[model samples]
Target: MDITRRRLLVLLPAAAVAWEFVRAGTPESAPNYKTSEHWWGMLIDITECIGCGSCVRACAQENDVPDGYYRTWIERYHVTDYAIERPQVESPNGGKEGFPMNEDSSGKNFFVPKLCNHCADSPCTQVCPVGATFVSPDGVVLVDKNYCLGCRYCVQACPYGCRFINPKTNTADKCSLCYHRITKGLTTACAEVCPTGARQLADLKNPKDPIHEYLRTHSVQILKPHMATGAKVFYNGMDGSVR
Candidate 1:
């Protein structure tokens, strides 16, 4: 293992948090938390989203994302009923400032909030020459900025256009589903701050997680299913016109 990575491994088990004691059914003598027990993902409900930009704002605040770039963003789409024309999409300043009203009123409109799909067979991880980008045991794709070469291969490889060069750190950057918080047994900042509950953090491996019930009842779809990346962020009530 890389020496810097070894240091991170050592820190995770030693660092203490108050929430560690809050877990029920965990005896005082229980073993350390295992990453394999939890596989992280997200759920986005297109119908429930109001384009309020709360998730985008919360993500930026929690992650310290720089201006003119977004870790998560809302896109407004105006689509026609017929397959006659291309849909109009707008994401002003990555929708952090909310949106202007639609004047055309010719077709249905919806808000689509997008982030790193955290694909199981992630292209970003495959193209990283220095082993900086990788999928964790818990299924969250992460970037070890210390190991990144700023080569931008992963940036181009990501089909979702989620990856970007963090000018401040000079490394590839995208959402980790708030890995720092989720590993600590808390929900993601975006999911927690969403006023309408449009976005949700999902633990696919947990039998008790509500995501299992939701998935069973809803006709969920992953973005770009043909790419076959095993994209985990499932969308409910997604329209066919959405790209």
Candidate 2:
């Protein structure tokens, strides 16, 4: 081989390009992934929650959520006797720093973690004028930031108060059930970080999923059944006072 200066220059650039591609890694591909084969949901055991706020912290860190905004959050409910219908709720700093000791002797207090319900008939998706927010075939709702108009319509349409405008993108954002991770066969950050195993990722289409057994054995309910949003998030041991 005759090594020349001109040949070295061309080889060096080609090698650099090849190295960059190698360093970037191959994009994950799932040839067998069938969206119809999956129906995503979440199971939350209210009784198992310790109000520790680990899930909230993990969600923020994983998603790069802006300060003063939350893709997921925890609410501390104080339901006093005889006033169960009007429970006082507080989520100071989205309960990321944990909650104060319950001082109210007359009421029962508990923590409830909140995120997108990923409803089958989500009002958020219904109100998107640009169709930027949509439910995936796998049942996870996602937002296409590039197509979003940032009109806040989805935010107003969501009954669960999940959607928020991202200051950096100027688009509506909410929990996607960690679609990026789920597609790669990983659980959501919140579920992964829950100390008490209170949060669980469920796949309705998977017959072997534990959610089926949990539903059979536990009395679970979705928030606001009256709306009939077809919400998939199931909560066990939820207090009647929780709104």
Candidate 3:
């Protein structure tokens, strides 16, 4: 059998993991989904984001995200006209209720949403002692909540600050790209609720997806490129001041 890299991560045999999934109540079917045929990512149009918090609210409701912690959040950036000034950033309560009025008149403000980059070379996966964190076949970095050790190694290893210890589950948690929904051919909650369509669920392997056309003709960048983590979240119309 041609097993995927993700399936091989668990110490137990493939059949055993499948059984565990069944035990954990994960759905057994995805309606003809083939992970190898899809590569998941996100395209963020920073210019179109209105900081409305619709995405944040939808993700919380959809995933049951705990308060004060965020799987996906937005940051407001105040980039001044002055060339050397650093951008002022804020995300009060993970920006779930929209942002406060910007008082700085000398600068322009924009919103940047942040989430798990789902890096192909994710350091979180490398740091997991129990193989609980792994990259899925479709390129999304995910945690095996049932198997997590609660050691917090993966959380500490993540450069993007995406992972956190789920107080409810006592395991590492972050965005899974809405795996349950996407496997059934549905968009992520954040993407679906984005009022301006600024955030889009992208399938890099699908040639017909608009992401390919956008990437070919527009300037896009991954966060902290010097780390070389192979982050999949691509940002467009981003200012250099954004971290």
Summarize candidate 3's per-residue lDDT along 68-177 as a digit string, tens digits. Answer: 88999999988778753588889988899999887775778899999999999999999999899999999999889999989999989999999999899999999999
RMSD of each: 10.5, 9.0, 11.0
lDDT of 2 by residue, 108-168 (tens): 8888988899999998899888889999999998999999999999999999999999999
Q: Which ten residues in a row have the lowest lDDT in candidate 2?
A: 24-33
lDDT of 1 by residue, 1-243 (tens): 565988988777765443556554364344355798999999999999999999889999999999988999999999977752588889999999899889888778899999999999998999999899999999999999999999999999999999999999999999989998887778999999999999999999999999999999999999999999999999999988788
- Can you list the residue pairs that collide in candidate 2? none
Error of 1 at 223 (Å): 0.4
- Per-candidate TM-scores read 0.87, 0.87, 0.86
| Per-residue lDDT of 110 in model 1 | 91
Q: Which stretches of model 2 miss by more than 4 angstroms? A: 1-31
Clash count (model 2, backbone only): 0
lDDT of each: 0.91, 0.91, 0.91
